[model samples]
Target: MTSSTQAVELQSFLSQITDRDKGLTAACAAIAEIGAAAAEMAELIALGRLYGSIGAATDHKNTDGDVQKQLDLIADEKFIAALRRAPVAVVVSEELNEPLVLNEGAPIVVAIDPLDGSSNIDANVSIGTIFSILPVLPGAGEPTAHFLQPGRVQLAAGFAVYGPQTSLVLAIAGKTQIFTFDRRVGAFIRTSADVQIKEDATEYAINASNYRHWDPSVKIFIDDCVKGADGPFGRNYNMRWIASLVAEAYRILLRGGLFLYPGDHREGYADGRLRLCYEANPMALVAENAGGAATDGHRRILDILPASIHVRSPLIFGSVWLVDLVSRFYADPHFSPERAPLFAQRGLMRG
Candidate 1:
C-alpha cells in the first residue's frame, strides 16, 4: 500500500471513472485541467505580496453581491478557458450573472466557484476552487435551466484547496478520493481513497457574530454548546469559524465537526448566504460520498432542487448525528429552548 504503484494519478483515476463514455471522458478532462490551473494558482498565491496585492477588492461585485478580488477574476478566467477547450455546453460561475455558452450542443454543463474564499488570499489563509459537473439533459428549455437540477444528479463534483499543501478532494459516482500535489512528479498523487466521516464531533464552526440575527433555534443550539461541560450537552465543544468554505470543509472531512450557515432574519439572509448550485450542491455531494450528511435544516440537501442557478440556501452539514439534530429543531417549531437538555439526549449525549 505504500508503493507509488498503489497511488493513482489524476489522469489514471479519471480514466477509470469515465468508463469510455466520450462526454464523461471530456468532462473529466476539463476537471483535470482545472486542477492543473488551480495548482499553478497555488504557486502564485504562495509568492505573497509579489502576486500584486491580490487581496485588493475590485470596484465590482459578483452576482452573489460579494466584492470581487483580483485573484477571483483570474481564477474565473482560468476555469473558463479550460472548460471552453472541452466539450462543455454551459459554464455557470458565481461571478457571472448569466451562463456562458461554450460548445452549444456539448453534453456536459459545469458550475464553478473559481476562487472560493478569495477574501482570505491576502491573509495567507487557505482558499480553493469548487466545481460541479452535470450532463446536459436532452430537450432542455433555456440552457440555464439545466444547471438548476438537484445535487443528486451531479455527474462528478470536487474541490481543490490551496493551503500549506495543495490538495484535491473529489467525489465521482459513489466514491470519494483525495489527492495531494507532488512537486517531485508535477502531478496530483492519490493520498486517501473512499474517504468517510466518523461521528465523533467535538467541534462546531459558524460565524457567531451574527448571533442577534439568528433564529431562536440557532440561538438555542449555540447557547447549549457554549454551556459546554456544565450545559445540557454534557461535553465541552470547541468553536471554530474560518470564514472560508474550502478551509472549513477540508477540516471537517479530516476530523468530524458540524458546520452551519443557517438562514437568519437578516435583510437578505432569509435563504442563507451560500449558493445552491456551485457552493452547496458540490459540497453536499462530497459530504454524502464521504459517509457524512448534508441538509438545509429540514431536508436532505441533495433532494432539494434549485429554483435558480444562483439561488441561496442554508447549509448545515457534517456528521450524521449533528445534521439530524438540526433537522429535528427545524421539524418542531413548537420545541422550546428550555428543553435544550432533553434535546441533548437525542444529540451529543446519545450513546
Candidate 2:
C-alpha cells in the first residue's frame, strides 16, 4: 500500500492467514484494534498532548519495579479499554501485578507490554508494544500456572514499533509477516510478507556499559567483537544499542545482527533485563520464524517456563550463525575463541 491510499486492512490480512478457529479469528480482530489504538496513542505521544503528561516521570513504578512514564500508563489504559470490547478471556500486563479476568469462558489469554522502551520516551527515540496470545486453560482458578507456559505453546505473538514509520511484526503459527500503518486510511497494510533474517551478519547490539557486570561467556563474546579483525572473529563488527527492544528487533529483521541482554552478576539483574512473558517470548517466536535463533545464552528462549508473571530473562537473538556461536560459548567451556572460516582470509595452498 502507498503511504496515502489503503491497500489491505489488517483484519483482512489476518483472516487470510487464520482458518476456521473462531476464537483465533476473534483474537486477531482484537489485536488489530489494539494495534490501531496503539498507533493513535503513539501519534499523541509524539505531539506531547496526551492524558496525564507525555514524557513526565510518574511517582509510580510498574509491577517489575520499573519507573512508569506518563505515556506508559496512558498506553496501558488505552490498550485495556480497547481489549474490553474484544472476545478475550484473560489479560496479563507488564504494568499490572496480577492478571485481569475479562470475558469468562472465552478462549484467549493475552500477555502484553503496553509500552516498551519507556526509557527512550523523553529522548524521542523509537518504542513500541508487544503481546503474546495463548489458549485459556480449562478449570483454572486465577490461571497463574497457565501464563507460565513455555513460549513454544504460544498461538500468536507480535509487536508494533513506533519509529520513523510505525509497523507491526507478527509470527502466527510459525509464519512471520510485517504490516505498516497507513495513517492516511487509519489502518495497517501489508508491507512485507514472510520476512526472514539473513543467516550471515557481523553486526551486534548490546550495552557495552554493562560489560564488567556480565558473565564470562557474555564478556568474552563482546571482547571478541570489540577486537574485530585483530581478534578471534577476524572481521570488523558494528555495535548498536538503542535500548529499545522493538526498534532493535526491527533492524535485525531487515538486515541482520545479534542482540544480547544476558543475565549478569549484577544484583536484581541476575535474570537479565527483559521480561520473559511479554518481551523475550514473543521476540523469540518472531526471530525463529524469520530463520533466526533466540536463546538465554544457555538454552532456547522459547523452551524456558516462566516462574512468575513478570519473570525476567537473558535474551540473545539474531542471525543464526551468530546466535549459534553465543550458545556454543555456554554449551562448551573448552570451546576456543577463533575466527570463523567465513571471515578468515583466503590464501594460496601451503606446503
lDDT of each: 0.85, 0.82
Instruction: Name the top lDDT candidate.
Output: 1
lDDT per residue for candidate 2 within 292-314, as digits (tens), equals: 89999888999998999789999
Q: What lDDT, from 0 to 1, does candidate 2 have?
A: 0.82
Off by over 4 Å in 1: 1-5, 20-23, 333-351
> What local lDDT does model 2 show for residue 303?
98
For residue 251, give model 1's deviation from the true position in Å.
0.7
lDDT of 1 at 105: 86
User: What digit string (tens of lDDT, one per residue) describes model 1 on residues 133-196?
Assistant: 9988788988788897889999889899999999999988686788899888989988988888
